[model samples]
Target: MGNETNEFDRVTMFGADWCRDCRRSKALLDSLGVDYEYVDVEADLSAADRAEAISGRKNIPVVVLPNGKHFVEPSDAELRGELEAAGVL
Candidate 1:
């Protein structure tokens, strides 16, 4: 985990450990030294509902940004751009 600048500095990722994309996204975040809160949808069923509330779909690797924006199963490039835009990269 990285520094916590404020309440909104947290990056919330909703996905299960078995998900490949989730692992990839987490790796990217870790590589870039970004702190994130990983919500395992499988471990806690209620987390799936939270993911649906944010994404409007049942998609693994739903990444919720600090500003409440999200990317659903984004590519590496897409995730990179988001990290750059957030000043994390």
Candidate 2:
């Protein structure tokens, strides 16, 4: 788990199991020991809508940060940059 004092204490990742980028992002978070809530868009249709609303696009792997910022289908480097910017790195 990540630091509780940081803004990334608990993030929300909106994605589907079948998505490659989602899996990669999840792996990155896990490797970084980041605490996050995984929301399966396939299991819950509303999650897809929520992801779209947050990112303003129909893309999976939407990572919702604790500070209300979000990343949609971000690469590992992008994720790292965001985490670092948020003081989670």
Candidate 3:
């Protein structure tokens, strides 16, 4: 992800490609037609640190909603609820 001021303004998901939960969430976002930023923690140490800082957990798939709320290792149903609540779904 870039260092743009608006980077986190939208729905941002910090995760690695190899993570099953990450892939599942990514697919959910895609299926819902929700726009989001995917930060590959495997590719950027700083992004990983940021994700940990946001969720206070060393877990993959830290999904930050546009409202500044975050979910760590959330299930598909949880993601769906959040997206719907955020009016993105």
Q: What's the CA RMSD for each of the models?
A: 5.3, 5.3, 4.7
Off by over 4 Å in 2: 1-9
What TM-score quantifies how close candidate 3 is to the native fold? 0.89
lDDT, each prediction:
0.80, 0.82, 0.85
The 10 consecutive residues of candidate 2 with the worst lDDT sum are 1-10
Best by TM-score: 3
Model 1 Cα shift for residue 74 (angstroms): 0.8
Quote the lDDT for 83 in model 1.
Answer: 78
lDDT per residue, candidate 1, 1-89, as tens digits?
22322334578888888899999988888887888888899889899997887777898898877865688898889988887887666
Candidate 3 segments whose C-alpha is farther than 4 A from its true place: 1-7
Candidate 1 stretches with Cα past 4 Å from truth are: 1-9
Residues 1-89, candidate 2: write the lDDT tens digits: 12223334468899888999999999999999988899999999898887787778897888877766788888899898888787666
Q: Give me the displacement of residue 45 in model 2, in angstroms.
A: 1.4
**Model 3 Cα shift for residue 28 (angstroms):** 0.6
